[model samples]
Target: MEFSVSDLAVARGGLCVLEGVSFTLAPGAALILRGPNGIGKTTLLRTLAGLQPALAGRIGLPPEAMAYAAHADGLKATLTVTENLRFWAAIYGTGGVEAAITRMNLAALRDRMAANLSAGQKRRLGLARLLVSGRPVWMLDEPTVSLDAASVALFAEVVRGHLAAGGSALMATHIDLGLAEAQVLDLTPFRAKGQGQATARGFDEAFA
Candidate 1:
């Protein structure tokens, strides 16, 4: 699937957090959203995932074609790891979720309660939901948070594999993820503008 954000703006209580943000992603490509704290990175990802409404402009996404992984685990504390994944898989209409769970190295924790897991373990479980969802587009917010070096490497490999399989991704990360060909869009330029306004810079141009 392909996505394009044209002059998209997000507002909370009449305060614009993101303005005039625009970008496009074709199949098999990735766009990295980059900026310092509270510059609307999470808000923008939510807007793209349709969790938040855009105050103005257009966000073109295929209907039900995206999977969003936020910083929050979004897992039921009462459920076991396997149970949580099963619930998400059923919701997403995914068929082969067991394989995904195994690939994420959650087999040992499969029967463990989600709330009992460590922070990084919970994050991995949350990420495993993505592998099962099978959505074409992935919007991840701070995907590397709470991850160790090994887990981060695993995450990078998973993302690379996703790109190789012709899927698209929009990721907000503070650290380098070792993505060879990923494009970066800095949101700093858009943060200084007034409410209801927007600014955008292309990844190529910004990096240059």
Candidate 2:
């Protein structure tokens, strides 16, 4: 599915962070968001994922066609590695656990409980979720966190495969995922004016 955002205004905790943000991603393509911390990168991703509403403008693409991966792994500690992938596959109606395990190089740890995995292992499992989501548009936040060089390479490979299969992705990260062809959207220029301004106390009472 193709994705587009037009003149979007994003807010977090009642504070507007980004405004007039716009971009598009066609199938077989990717878009990378680059910015420093506290600059609305995560907020923009979350807004696109429907975790929060956009303050203004529009996000094109059906909510069902989007799959979001937050910074957290969202794994059940008691479940095995394969079990985790299998569970998501069942939910998404996409059976690719074995393939995903192989893709993420988790076959050796397939039987290990999620709680026992290292930080890098947990991050890999989190990334494997995209494979089973069965959704064409991926919204990822800091996907390469905690990965080593080899694992990062594996991630790049799978992402390429996704694009090749007519899937698109929007990723927000400071580090490069090695997506050489992906379009970059820098959020710095769109930062909202007076983003952190606090409302005056007397104004509320006067209005009331």
Pick the TM-score winner: 2
Query: Per-residue CA lDDT of candidate 2, range 1-208, in tens?
Result: 7788999987766677789998889999999898878888988888888777777889998988998988898898999999999999988988988999999999999999999999999999999989999899988888989999999889989999999899998998776777766999889999998877632221111100
Please, what is the TM-score per model? 0.89, 0.92
Q: How accurate locally, in lDDT, is each candidate?
A: 0.82, 0.86
lDDT for position 82 in model 2 = 94
Runs in model 1 deviating more than 4 A are 195-208
- Predicted candidate 2, C-alpha RMSD: 4.7
lDDT of 1 at 112: 98
Poorest 10 consecutive residues by lDDT, candidate 1: 199-208
Clashes within 3 Å, all models in order: 2, 0
Error of 1 at 180 (Å): 0.9
- Per-residue lDDT of candidate 1, residues 127-208 (tens digit): 9988888899999988988999988988888888899999989998877888876999999877736654432321111100
Candidate 2 stretches with Cα past 4 Å from truth are: 198-208
